[model samples]
Target: MRFLVTGTAGFIGFHLAQRLLREGHQVVGIDNFSTYYDPQLKEDRNTILETYPAFSVERLSLENAPALNAAWKRHQPDVVVHLAAQAGVRYSIEHPQAYISSNIVGTFNVLEAARQHGVKHLLAASTSSAYGANLEMPFRETDKAVHPMTLYAATKSATELMAHSYAHLFGVPTTFFRFFTVYGPWGRPDMALFKFANAMLKDDPIEVYGEGRMSRDFTYVDDLVEAITRLVLVIPSERPPVEGDTLSPVAPFRLVNIGGGKPSPLMDYIEELEKALGKPAIKTFLPMQDGDVPNTTASPALLQRLTGYKPETPIGVGVPAFVDWFRQRYDL
Candidate 1:
């Protein structure tokens, strides 16, 4: 199948595109290489993918409607996976407009391209943060995601709504998966795992938010990609009510949670990193920042029911894998 994936330079995007290419699929990737984290890292990821004959990349942002439409018309992709976005919970509090432009406007452009191309399956990335301000233990796809604590989450929720509208009005089949805390080798520098790993290697103090009380279901990147690959074929066809399905009543759209299904404490994650690096981090406890949630756990029932798989890599193993990569990458 021919796949056009946005954010191919990003962590999950890179991994997903590689996985597809390894499975012998032709992939056309698009990324603006934003300075959100580091363009060097994005370039390095693209370099690796460019080595594959089946993979090709275009340098452009999704906000560029003409460019995006041109790429869509050229590739005529069988599937479109929209993963590019201004991603950061805390960063969203400082720069709300970035979230609007990238998450909102960027997603809008992707929807328009997909609608025009009449793609078979459109899979977009959402976040567990969409379940904001809800004290629920394990979030389900059908749960209310109306109360987003952060602008980033709000934009993602808005994208889901916007995609639903497009799917209903234009008959575009869409699947939006809400991700928990995703981490692994080639992870984003802005995420807690990368920040903690960098600080620990330098013997610097790691900022423990929520006084080390926060928790998250840290889904490994490879596992998330596997779920995504499987979901590519599980496209929604109609609005038939199925058990554990979040299928929209009016469109060929559904929501699934891609997570580990096991929420780990912030302190526990830190300890795992310490173990991985063979060094303890100087910890600085701080109150929770704005637009941050204390804990997030995914039910994963819908994902399992749909894909027959769930993320199972625990922190103990995943953290060490990332530490190894960090050490090799930085010559630590």
Candidate 2:
């Protein structure tokens, strides 16, 4: 299959593209290489992807509709995985417009391109943060996600609606997977695991958010990529609706949560990092920051029904893998 994947330089995008390439698929990657983090990291990831003859990338942003459409026309991919976006809950508070442009407008452009090209399936990334203000233990795909605490979440939720509209009106088969706290080797530096590991290695005190009360359903990157790979074939209109399915009645659209349905405490994750680094983190416990949630646990039922797999990597194993990669990447 020929896939047009956005954000191929990003953490999850890099992992997903590599997996597809290994399976002998042709991937046409698109990334602007935003400086939201170290561009060096993005360059490094793209470097590895470039080594695969089946992979090719265009340095452009989704905000640039003309460039994006031209690339889509050139590649004419069978599947389109839209993953690029301005990410970060707290960062959205400071720069809400970035989320508006990249998350909302960027996704809009991708949907337009996919609809125009009549792609076989359009898969995009959403976040568990979309399940805002819901006190449910394990978030199901059918849950009402209207109460977004952050602009970031709001934009992602809006993306879901936009895709649904495209699916309904244009008859585009679309699937948006809401990701949990994803972490692993070559993970984003801005994410919690990377920050904690970097601080611990530097002998700096790690700030424990929510006063260590928060917990997350952390899904390893490989598990997430595996689920996504399997989901590419499970188009919304093709599959019979399973129990707890979020498939839209009117549109060929569905939302699946890629998680283990397991919520581990924040402290437990930190402890795993400590074990990986073989050093106790100097702790600075702090209250929960604004736009932060206390916990997130995905149901994972629909994902398992659709793909017969769910993320099961525990922090103990995942944290160690990340630490090893971190050490090797930085020569620590």
Candidate 3:
């Protein structure tokens, strides 16, 4: 499949592109290379992708609608995987506009491109944060995701609705997957695992929000990429005019959960990282800040029903692998 994947420089995007390229798929990737963390990390990731003969990289942001539209028109891809977003729950509190621009508006651009290009199947990234204030264990696609606690989640939720609307109106087959806490090699710097490792390495106190009471289903990067790759073949069927589980009644669109179905406690995750790095972190437990959830777990039943797989990698094995990569890459 000739694919146009956004956020090719991102952690998940890089991994996904690599897997597809290794499998001999022609891939066209794009990224803005923003300083949200460090453009150098994105550049390094892109460099790795450049080694692939079937991979082509373009430097651009989703905000550039004209440029993105042209790329879509040029590639006329078989599939579209939209992963570019201004990602950070805490950062959203200060810079809500960034989330709106990148997640909401950026998603609008992708939907438009998918619709205009008449793409076969469209799979975009959503978040577990969309299940805000629900207090539901094992979040399902059928659960109501109306009350988003943070702007970041709100924008992502809005993108889901926007995609659904496009599917309903234009008959575009769209699959939106809610991702849990994703971590492993080439992870974002703001994520807990990365920060915890860096803090522990430098002998600094890693801030433990909610007094270390939170838990997360930290899906490994490879697991995530596999789930995504599998879904490329499972596009939503034609709308059948149904009523439950967000199965689009008007178009071929569905929302699926891609995550480790089991939840791991925050302290447990930290302990695993400590063992991986051979350094215990200085504790700084604090109250739960705004826009933070105590836990997030996914109900991968739908994913299994469709793709015959669920993310099952444990932190014990995954964290050490990531630590090894970090050590080798950064000389930690």
**Best-performing candidate as measured by lDDT:** 2
Best by TM-score: 2
Model 1 spans with C-alpha error above 4 angstroms: 238-241
Question: What does candidate 3's lDDT look like per residue over 23-112, in tens digits?
Answer: 999999989999999889999999999999899977888989999988888777898898989999999999988988899888898898
Q: How many backbone clashes does candidate 3 have?
A: 0
Can you rank all candidates by lDDT, best first? 2, 1, 3
| lDDT tens digits, residue span 169-283, model 1 | 9999999999999999999988888999898878889999899998899988889999999999898983365688988888999999999789999899999999888888999
Residue 106's C-alpha lDDT in candidate 3?
A: 88
- Lowest summed lDDT across 10 adjacent residues in model 2 is found at 237-246
TM-scores vs. true structure, each candidate: 0.98, 0.99, 0.97
How much does candidate 1 score in TM-score? 0.98
RMSD of each: 1.1, 0.6, 1.7
Q: Residue 186, candidate 3: how far off, in angstroms?
A: 0.6
TM-score of 2: 0.99
- Model 3 misplaced regions, further than 4 Å: 238-245
